[model samples]
Every structure is written in structure tokens, then in C-alpha cells.
Target: MEERLPGADRLPVGRRPSEGLRLPAPDRALSSRTGYTRGTWLAVADHLLDSLGPWFTPSGAQVRLPGRGSWSGADCDGLEGYARSFLLAAFRIAATEGDDRLVERYTRGLIAGAAGEWPRLTPCSQQMVEAAAIAVGLHESRAWLWDRLDGPDQQKVVDWLSGFVGSKTWDNNWRLFQVVGEQFLASVGAPYSQDDIDSGLDRIEDWYVGDGWYTDGDGQNFDHYIGWAMHLYPGLWTRMAGTAADERLTVYGDRLRRFLEDAVHLVGADGAPVHQGRSLCYRMAAAAPYWMGMLLDASPLTPGQTRRLCSGMLRHFVDHGVPDERGLLSLGWHHHFLPVTQSYSGPGSPYWASKGFLGLLLPAEHPVWTDREEALPIDEDDQVRAMPAPGFLLQGTRHDGIVRLLNHGSDHAAPGEGEPPADHHYDRLAYSSRTGPELTADRIDNHVALVGPDGTSQRGRIRRIAVDGRRAASWWKVGASRIEVASVVLGRVEVRCVLVDGPGGVTIRHGGYAIADQQRPEATTAGTWAQTVRTDRLTSVVVGLHGYDEAGVRLGLDTNAFGPHSATPYLVRREHPGGPVLLVSAVVLSGDTVWPEALAEAIEVEVDGLRCVIRMAGGPEEAEEVVMDGGGTPAAAGETS
Candidate 1:
């Protein structure tokens, strides 16, 4: 017998029941790759909305779903439930050309909340954030909801949103929330500051680093916010403003088009987006920009490619058990792992993923829905591409179907901010679609540090020297000393060469990818090489090619988001007299079987002072040489034979 929600029977017919929710049958003819048609998206939207029935408060003022509250308290969390979900409901109702049920349900909440059941939006308050979603919802569904409301109710709603007229937001992507909220107000003939809207849109120009990348703020704070919030809101604001956004639309559209060119390669063949940055709990929100690109007709991807990419990402999360059995989006990746969430993440925060459903705004007959799915970049061949603006070297292997990002820049710290503790998400030397950094342990992965009496050095505020071809170079400081690193990638392997200019008697430690599983991973070490293999055969390997001694594995319990038990392979050089010493190693993460000895034997390294040459047999590159100049910065010396 299938367990059904109170309104499950009223859901559309042809609904294919899953564990706790019902979705439509796959349309394999149109979406052969992901089998997720427009009907599938509609079913998901309706299922999620229907699942929220029991959580609505009396008078429909707030939904107030279960789970812990954020720093903003219960009132704000309740508002989040109503506002965020309203965004999804709005997309659904608008795209369907009007769904009376959804409109009426959210309309009651809007009216009651405007009548004072909800908290007033204050300066920089969390309510201010929810106000943007509410404003956008009202604008998108104006005909069915806002226009149908009585005059007094409409003014009450405007009164609540007028809180943004003089309120300030954080300098980061929060600025765009004001732009979106105020623009919607202007569209509806309410009190709005054009200055707030224009300034908020103009402020992002300062953070744009070209090549379609923008740091979240003044710092090197590049992350998912660049897409989900930064690009998503401005594009949405343009839609609400219609022809009023003509000039800015041209600029924003070009920027988004260029951004999709790079972002398209970031997802793995299996549809997982690179897991780097904050707010990862928003899961599929990474797909928001791709949809926006389609909405604005600014995408480099074909309609087939856009649908494939977007549907692939949406399916990846669904396959991983997002919206758990109870059909709730928990504050974690894949499952309920809290460490991946931020302090600001309330239970309803995950609903921000409603941004991904923006595709629903397009009608079923749209090309993005009707087009046949196409292959992703990773699905066809291996790739090695460099994005200099963000200082990332993207490597994708067709065989393993995994994509790795070698991070040479984009540390979530301001320049000259001094050395702070390493952020597991943003400060790692590498991140991938298939692996996550060990977030709750002393032993970190994808990192190289000089360990001394003070502690292991952090890769604070990366100073990027170069990012070209398959190689990237950056340097960081440990007190008075400097550590420079250059990485050359070939297939699934990354050969990292490090030069340290510091005191003596310190231990240099380097860790490989962290592989996690429900059970303890099989760990092995032999003669300067180490590897950990999960039961499903995903492997993380590290080998010391030069300036290192012993190899080992570190076990971590409940320290990873992928699973409960995790293992990291590490190599160490003891009693190092750190001045001008160069260390070289090869690290790998793949789904293929990796023999440690064969990997170590395939790579040869030669070090002379601060200059190092690395050669890999049967690798993509023939040979590469890296040298450190007098300033202690690594530079690639081009390909060598």
C-alpha cells in the first residue's frame, strides 16, 4: 500500500509514486539522458507543495516547518517557509498559466501576513531576505494573485516591502536582494528607490573579475553564490521590469552567457556540480543560472544542452535522497549532515533551492522542454581547461566521470587579511564533484602545510601567479615564511610541487582526497605511497615523488558529508630544514582501480634547489617543469621533453 499525503489523491494523474513523493513518468523520448520532462518538473513542484500542507500555521500566515531555528528565531524561519516556498509556487502558477489552487493557498498567506501576522521587515533583518522572494513571487504571479487582491491588502503588502527603501544590506550578494525587492515594488507602483535598485546592480560591477566571474564581495569570495544569487537575482529582476531593463539586460545577458561557458564544464558526467563554497545545502540551486541563461536567451549552450545540464543536476540530488522520505529538504548535502550547513541555515533555508525550479516559468511547449537532451562536455571526452579569473584548472576524465578543480585562487578571505584558519570549503588546494574535504577533523585533505609548534599553516588569501593550460601556481605565507605551490594535471593525476622558505625542523604534510563511506574504507600504504578505497571502488591516492618520507592513512569518524566513516591518505617529510626546500607529490581521485606502486613508478620527479621537473609515463602531458623565482613564487616553465 502506498502512503499518501492528505491531498495526494488530488495530485495530477500519471504520477509515479516514489518513496515519499509522487512524480510523473519519465519522458524518455524527449529527455533520453535524464528522462525528466516538463511534466516531471511539475509533478515535483506539486508534490513538494502538497507535502507542506501539514506544516501551515492557522490562517496560513506561516508554514513553520520542523527543525532547528537560525539566529533569526522562529518568526523568521516561519517567514522563510512561506516566502521561499511561495517562490516555487509562483513559478509553478505562472508557468502553468494559472493554477488556482496554488495561487489561493499562497494568496491567503500573503494577505494574512500583510495583515500583521508576519514580522515587519527591518534593516538588514532576515525578513528583508524573505521580502525579496515574496516581492518576486507577487510580481511573477500578479495576474492570478496580486491583481486579484483587494486594494487594502495590496497596500498592506507594499507597506511590508517598503522597509527596503532605506535599509542597507551586506556588501556581498545580499545587495541584490534589495535590487530585486525594490524593482518588484517599482513594477507595482509602490514606493521604491531607483537609487537602491541601480546602486545594487552597479555594486556587483566592482566585484566582477572578468571572464564572467564575480567574487561574492570585496574579497576573493567566489562560490555558488556567484550563480544562484548573484546572477539569478539580476536576471530575475530584469524579467520583472520587462522593457525597463533593456540596456542592463544586454550587459547582464552577455555576462551570463560568458559565465555559462565556464560553468557548463564544472559539473561531472554524473550531474554533480563541483562541491566548493558555502550554502552547499541549497543543492540543485547550482542549476539556477543555466535556467536563467535560457530565460534571457543568453546561453552558449543549446536548448538541448541546457535541459540536459539542468535536468542532470536536478536528478543528481533526487538520486542522492534529497527531500528525505518525508519530502523535506534538510540542511545538508545528500542527507542530514549538519556540518555542511552554515550558522545562518535554518530548516527552511533549503527551500532556497526553489531557485532551481525557475525553469518552470517557461511553458511546456518551450524549446528547453521540447528539445531532446544532449551530451555534456564530460560525457564525450576528457578535458583540461583553465579559468584565470577565478584561478581554477578544471580537469575532467571521461573514464572515471569525475571532475576536479585545482584551486589556485578564490580563497574566501580579503587580500592582506592576515593568516586565518583554513576554511574546509574555500581554502583547500582542490575540490571535486565526487569528493568533499574533511570538514570536522584535524587532518584535512587536498592540502599541503608546514606543521610546527604553532600549528599547521593555512593557505590563507591565495596569491595567484599563473593559471595556464593544465598548470596553475599560487603562494601563501606561514608567518615570516612563504610557501609556493604549482600543480600540473594529467588525466586523473595532479603532480604538485611545493617550495618552502621558512625555519628548520618542521614537518611538511600533504593529504590526498578524502574518501568516505558508510563503512570504514580500505586503507593501504607502502613505501612513500598511500591510498584509501571506498566499498563502491572510489579511490583516493597520494605518492611522494620527492622531498617526502613516510606515507599513511588518517581515519575520521563522522567527519565528512558523503558518509559517516572517512579516510585520507597523507605523505609526510619529517625534520625538514624548510628554507628553499622543494617537495613534489602526485595525488589522484578516481573510480578506476589505482595501483599505488604503478602510479609512483609512472611519475618521475627531479628537484634542484627550487626548480623541479616532473615526467609522467603514459600521461596526457609529456613532461612539465616548474621553477621558483627569487620572490618565492612558482612559475610554469612550459612543456618539457
Candidate 2:
């Protein structure tokens, strides 16, 4: 039976529900004054499940999502895809409180798949991820399915899931896959290696980089996976292990609490989560960490605030046509855009978004449902926070409620790989809650590139030096060229300075925001000083305040993962004269009116480059010299209220 504390209904709504947040209420039992209820989300989930009927194979072994291409990583796409989606469907169905015929049908399909009755459902090393999902799903619905199954069927399920016991998993987040699978095995009194469980848990701890962040692996692989998979698993593992692992549960609780503190700040006021990292296609899975925190009681957020963040994020995608007219989740950020997916991502991969519905596991009477919805940190005020582990300085704007991440850290490119190629997903100089990375392979946005003699620019892996308050610095290699850059950001303005030490005199191409432009853009240029391109929903403008020899609006061809085409207004300085070159540019992105008053600030630099001053909307004397390194603690300066 689920436990609940009375008087939860008396809890105040932390803040008025935002303007566009048409989210479902926490649950059904807790009567919402609005017509909205958790049933709305259930309907979406059911529709998603029903949409898969067209893709299921004869034996239900594989479910190819309605998409064109297949990933090369797996020999069989349908098997992994079907298993993963089924795991989600089964888990949700098991936790749901209602009489739904679809649930029974899905449960039967999962049983057949798990029992290996589907000859096409072959086991492989990559299947370890799916295997864990299946095991966890069975555990989550143990009373409804696992316990009801006959001895032979239960053995079949156990025998099939046992494939992960001694399997070879990837070194990174894949470690958690093994750990969760083993935890499930242990829960059922089945054969599981305690050594495997202990070692997997210990190894995952190595990925933890403090300040509520994990590297995903040894190199710079930080992304949503930290919240969706890395953190989500520990909570699930704790619940699966129960009292037997109380000591480890305490450790996980503390770590998860710390992580949520940072994670909550990443969401934008518009309900969009930070649009960095890979698997941009797993649209709503970004909410998994918050939901997991709720599940484990390890979060710092109030119950209402947790529901608000999770529900708001889900509604954000839903409002954007995530489930197309046919009710199918596509392989892209919002609608269908193929570039958003990695090679390992298959059609069924998006089903991982079901992890967002983890709150369904909580009983309806729980305070999370009874309490009033609260505002996110970004919603409450404009703020800036520096997360050292990820090498990011987070900036949240009060007017727009958009959270921008100044990334001095995180690149998908592995470390020590002689010369690693840059994946624009993680290498971008900045990412926001509203915009996406410019996906053009060569000419990337939100980046500083060293242009060769042939005009083709090269991007190198950037190693972070420090981030203090609104200031951040990093070093990157462009071919044989080595460049260091420092940025002092306030609102939309980022004053940047680049120091070059290389073999040849190179051109520095500082690209700004990659604003999505489906319609014709109203473009304006002011010689080499500034350029502004405005679409209906987005406006990208870049002003060269200093050191830029030329500035122009560059169009990226099918270069954005979020949208089809993007326009980047970049400032270029040629014939670098080889030494330290300072380029200060103001990049502004807004759906609202672009105010000149906010952009009028100027950056002043001294001869030695020792001190940089930001003259705010006020005057020169009000000019405050920003510490380039922020004295090593950037966020300590607190929000510029």
C-alpha cells in the first residue's frame, strides 16, 4: 500500500501557474481546481503506445519506429527498439491506476518477448541496455505480471534477463545498465553477482565530478544522460535493492540532491530544458532526473515545484507537436529532424521519454499530487550559476526566463585522442533553453574557428580553464593553431577576447547564435560593426564591439538539428598579427522585442589585458572590472538581482 500524509491539500500553490503552462495536474485523487488532471498525460502515453502497432513484427520481437534510416551500431534495430519501448509501456501500465485493455495486450507482448518466444529477439552485448530495462519493468510491475506468471514463465523471464549478468557493457553510463539489471536479478532471488553489482556501483561513482555533475565517462561526455540515465538509475537501484542496500541508498540520496540543485536551474522559463548534449531526440526524457528525485525522496525541490518542472517540460514538447498528427514520437527535437539523432539511436529510442512519467509510480494521495504547483528557479528570478564540474556558467534572464549556458566545458570528443574532431553538440561556446546547436559540420555556430588559407575553418576540442561568475575561459587547438579565449557575459552580451599562438597568421571567425529561419528573415547590416537577422519566432543579432575586422550574417545550410536552416551572424578578423587579439561581441536572441537599452553596454580593456571592465546600461564610471577568472568561484557572486 502507498503511504500519504494528510493536509497536503492545504499546501499553497508556490506561484501562479505560468501563462503557457497548460500542464496536467499532479494526479487524479488530488482534485485539481482546473479541469486538467494526470489522465491527460495518461492519454498521451496510451496514444504513443497505440501508434506503435504499425511497427511491431509478427512475433513482437522488434518494433521499428516510424522512421526511414537504421543505426549501424546494432545488427537488429527492431529487437532493441521493441524491447526498450515495451519496457516503457509495461512499466507505465503496471504503475497506472485504471482498467485499460491496452495494458493487458502490452503485458502479453512483453512476456512473449521476454520468454524468448520471439525467435527474432536475439541477445547481444548492446542488448544489455534493453535487458536492464526489461528487468526493471518486470520488477516495477512484479505484482501485476511477474507474480501472476506461472513458474515456468517466470523462469523464462529470469533466464532471458540473466544475459546481462556477465555481459560486456560500455565503460560509461552503460555501467549503470549492468548495475540496475543485477539489482533486479537480486530482487527476485535470481542468480546475480554481488561482485558485479558492487563493482558497477563503485565504477559509476568515478563518473561523478562533484557539484551535482557526472562526466558520463572519463572524457568530456557530460549531457542530459547525467540526469536521465546516470542519476535515474541510482534511485531505481535503491528502490530495487530496498533495505538490504540502505547504506548505498544514503550515498545516492545525497548525490542526487546535489545534482538536482544544478539540474533544476537548467530549465528555461518557457518550459524548455537546456538544449545541449546528444540524444536531442529523446525529447522529454530530460525530466527523468527530477522524477527520479521525487521517487527516491532525494530532491531539494518542493513537491509542487517538482511536478511543475516535470509537467511543464512535458507540455513544452507537446505544445510543439512532439507527437505528430499520427500520435507517434518522431526522431528529432520537436518534430521530425533526422540530424538530431546519433548513429546509435533507432526509432524506438524516443520511447525513453516515457521515463518522464515516473511520477505515476507515486500514489495519487502523495503530497506531490496534493501540493500546489511551484515555480522553477529560473521562473522565480534571473540568475547566473557556475558549475565547475561541467565547466559551465549558467545565465538565466528574468525578462525572457531563458536559461543560457556558457559552456567552457564538455565536448563529446574524447580526451588524449591526439587531434579529436569536434561534435558541435557539446563543443558549442554557448547553449540555451530556447535555441539549439548549429549542426553544420564545418562552419559551426556559437564557436570561434580558425580559418585556414583556403577559407575552410577547423574546430578543435576546447579544454576549460575556469569559469567565475559571468566570466569563463578555455583553450582550444585549431589544426596546429592554439588559441585561448576569455568571455565576460551579462544578459545577452558576451565580451570575448582571443589570444592566438600558432604557426601562421589565421583568421578568427566568431559565430553567434544559429537562429532558426524557416521563413524569409528581415536582415540588416551595419558595415563591420553589427548584423541582425530576425525571423518570426527568433531574432539573432551580433555586434562587434571591438577587434573585429569584418562582420556578416552567414547562412547555415540544413545545419541546425532543431530546425531545417539557421542563420549565424559571425564577426571575422583576418591577418591576426599572431599575438593576443581581443574581440568583444554582443549576441542577442529573443522572441520579444530587442531593446537597444539592454545592448548599449560596452566592454573596455586595458593595455596589458590584465583587467576588463563592463560598462553597464549606466555609464563609464559605473564600469566594473570583471575578474577574468572570477577568482575561481564564478557562481559565488550570486544572481545579479
Local lDDT at 328 for model 2? 69
TM-score of every candidate relative to the true structure: 0.95, 0.88
Q: What lDDT, from 0 to 1, does candidate 2 have? A: 0.69
List residue ranges in candidate 1 displaced over 4 A.
1-18, 620-622, 629-641
Please write out the lDDT profile of model 2 over residues 528-590, one tens digit for every residue: 544444454466667666667877776666666545566777778877776455556667666
Instruction: List candidate 2 segments past 4 Å from native.
Output: 1-36, 72-75, 97-100, 115-124, 595-611, 619-622, 626-641
Inter-residue clash pairs, candidate 2: 62-78, 468-634, 469-634
Q: After superposition, how far is residue 402 of candidate 1 from its true place, in Å?
A: 0.8
In candidate 1, what are the lDDT values of residues 60-118, reduced to their tens digit? 87988888779899988999999999999999999878999998899898989988988
Error of 2 at 626 (Å): 5.3
Clashing residue pair totals per candidate (backbone < 3 A)? 0, 3
Clashes of 2: 3
